[model samples]
Target: MNSIGNIKPFLQKVIRSGVGRWRFFAATLGLLVALVIILLSLQLYLNFNQLLHGKANESETAEFLVISKEVTAENQSKKNESYFLPEEIALLGKQPFADRVGEISSTNFIVTISSFSNAFPFYTDAYFESVPDEFIDIKTEDWSWKQGQVNIPVIIPSFFLELYNTGMAMSQENLPRLSLEALQAIPLRVNIKHSGGTAEFVAHVAGTTDRLNSVLVPEAFMQYANKAYGYQESKPPTRLVLKTLDAADPALQSFLVANSYTTNSDKTKLNKARIIVNWIAGVVGIIGLIMLLFGMLVFTLFIQLTIAASRMDIVLLQTLGASPRQLSGYLMGMFMPVYGAMVMIALLVLSVLQYGIHQLLLQKQLLVSPWLSVYTLAAAALWLLLIWFVNKRTITNYLKAG
Candidate 1:
């Protein structure tokens, strides 16, 4: 302790004089440059990854369907075709179905339609006129189907008018008529008798015989039309849609499938890929941090070597009663300003870059992800530990070499 106290003034003089400045300056500059390059590269990589994820989400949403069924698993294999639900179910819960499921339906209808000419106003006009003066009662409409709705809208074929060659022009609103052109045809309409004593509406129209003449109406309205036209009342669909649950979470998914189900997102591969990319990013980050630490180590080592090589100067200080610990403190203190500045600058630049990225990707619904935070903090800690280890080792090496 007395030796260290005696060494303090001599060690302080050496540092305060700022000897061998150029080499250390060059090494520090090199570290800063490397940090800039690494940060830029990582930012670019994550941006590209985010764009890819967005496109994948869009594509997957477009191509799947859903089915909800109540039958047991044994029934799925039964050869009875009557119990088999339609293979393609449209959007589940909105129109064709409602917005409930996410599939397309395969059922199609064909029919011929004739307008009432002067005998009938246009179909659109006819329907519009039926509404009350101040208030209107109409079903919400959509071009596609989902599930969970009581009624669904249908799109009529565009070729219907051309095929009939019904030269007579009629109300654009009510130009076409519907009917069965052949026997065994699914009724064009179904009659819906509300449980009320007398109220009823015509709903869904099944397939017709002719393709060009088909008309589309709400499922409920078609039923009412069948009854008004003396056809049998539309019966409830005998079959329900079914689909298999994937094995990943078979119990819960299977139960949901039994009730109302659609295609499940297969996220195993996606999750695996995410882990891999993050790991790679982490590795890259670690490498950059390692390089930074190595540069710092090299700088410390270079300073220590320069001091050791100037043995005559160290001996002169020793003659002046300098102690080892004070020499160590003196050497470390020489770089204090540089270390502090480097840390502050690195943190400041990173904060600005991250803030800019956040602003740019905000509207894209992009996020850094929670895991990114965890990985980043872990990386920083690892780098700090590496730096500390390297710093200590450099000091020890200098003392031994001396």
Candidate 2:
């Protein structure tokens, strides 16, 4: 109880003296720290995200080729007539490094979601959640990114609805079931008349990549459409897609050459480029870190100067029998308000930066990970601790010098 009474006077004296004349400098130091933290956080996020996407794309490679000519038996006799096919090669990629054997198929078309109109609606039947404007798509393209989802969309039969006991029974076992909530919120509506008397298919949502207003269907639907729509000749694919299991630099190159197939070295080049880019980014991160450290050092020096200017008063306390423990606690306590302000300002600044970046990505329909929030907060706290320790050392040195 007596110790508590003695500690109260030291705390009061520190608080009263610490907030003396340099209020503006303390505020400016804090603001600069906040700004530096924000910038570092944003740059780290951008670079990290870029690396993730680039690495993902790099793992799966697809070979694109255009057929220029075809040889035939009749051409040996006189000059056989040559014709072109409409199908394109699509290879679903598998293991990239050790086992490269993959499945190959022909796709009628690549359904890339290019852009969307003003009203983008949600799907009720989809188990996977959708974020507005995110680069998520349901594609017939054979790639790792396009797998795992049911791409072949068919009409939600009345029978499917009946299975759920919604009283719209048709045939429970034969039809595909979807939620009525999703059906009502369908994103696209268009009549696709088939070529050979097949039923016209319609969709609730449209693909965004193509300016074409229709929702994309699978190869079966396209074939059905061609027969009904009177497409005369079927287009043959130019080349077969090759998948390799060995992703080693030398092995990949050798495999392509041995097969007499030409491939672009772009993926290899990009990986190398990232090494340099990441190094540069790391250097910039370090520089920002140094600036933050320098700012804290300047603030600590100012605090030291303040204490030195009041050295005579400290000496008077020592003469009055104030213990060394009391003097140390008083000086450390003075910094509590400054450290608290710095931490709060850093958090506010980082939050605003994150919000702005998230909104920008949302408008552009890009993927933004929420994990960035956790990373930024962790980094800020780490820097704050470093600054606190440095300030402690500065106070000790100042007292010794006085």
Candidate 3:
């Protein structure tokens, strides 16, 4: 108890080191705060960025191919045109390049569509197709159709609309060039002629996809719609949607060439903005790490300066029977409050910033977690431990050298 009582004087002296040398204290505090903010903020950004990108699947090697047999004069003369049999799909599954194979759910059933407005007077036979949900690049939440759902959601090729705008609509006085958004809003009445009766309902454009060049419906809806309205076929699909792990996989091209199967001309379109965001995060992270390292150096220097200023007192204390262990502990305690304050303040500020950013994302219809992720919290703890370890080591080493 008497030893503890005697140690208070040394503790007071160490704490008083920051009183006159306010510059060091303030600089250390500010630099550490900057370090923590930059480090944590950039880390948080990266975590959320990855989560968001994955949620959208904006670009993580999802390549879809609309593969159909190469039309040939000899094959065209035969009764059996071409179709992807179950065995062919199994063969594709065995290939090293293809990740998945989905039969393109296309209607052998007949379909005729007409505009609800007689002013448009548009009527034509349109083929409906649906690739698996994995193969479509469009958002799927708005792309479904049920018995009572608002309208049958359909995805059509972008070029099909471009053709109508350039060739069909330009020649006709009644038709207007439709944008994707406008086309999605407008409804088309589909009439399915079956068994001397026609069932009519409205179809809405869900979205357009660059992956496939044909009209698309949800696979579930295709089964229902066809069963209700068209003749059943025993034959397999002539068109298939191939899901490949890598767009640039050499085996994919070799197989396609070998089988004489063709796909859409567009290969892959990675989101340039996502790529730019990732690069920016990497650069910011590097800068933050440098600043953090500099902050640690400044803090270490602060400890050495304090020990130098109190060199005379330390010598007198040791001469009077105080040990280096007591001095190290006292110095570490002096810096402890600073570390604590920095952590609390940094976390508070980071929480507010993350909340604001998350709310902004919410407003944009992109949902992400508002709280700091486990990765950020774990990183913060590791950083704090590093600071504590370095500060303690500086005090112990300085005492030993003295």
State every prediction's TM-score relative to the real structure.
Answer: 0.41, 0.44, 0.54
Instruction: Show the colliding residue pairs in model 3.
Output: none
Deviating ranges (above 4 Å) for candidate 1 = 1-9, 15-20, 36-290, 316-321, 367-378
Cα lDDT listed for each candidate: 0.43, 0.46, 0.74
Query: How far off is residue 184 in model 1, in Å?
Result: 30
lDDT of 2 at 269: 39
Worst 10 residues of 3 by lDDT: 265-274
Identify the leading candidate in terms of lDDT: 3
Candidate 3 stretches with Cα past 4 Å from truth are 1-6, 14-19, 47-51, 57-270
- Residue 144, model 2: Cα distance from true site in angstroms: 21
Look at candidate 3 and tell me the lDDT of residue 332.
Answer: 79
**Separate clash counts for every candidate:** 59, 25, 0
Candidate 3 on 308-391: residue-level lDDT in tens? 878777777767767676766678777777777777777777777778877988898776678877677677777789888999
| lDDT pick, better of 2 and 3 | 3
Q: What is every candidate's alpha-carbon RMSD to the true fold?
A: 13.2, 16.5, 9.6
Positional deviation of residue 127's Cα in model 3 after best superposition, in angstroms: 11
Best candidate, TM-score: 3
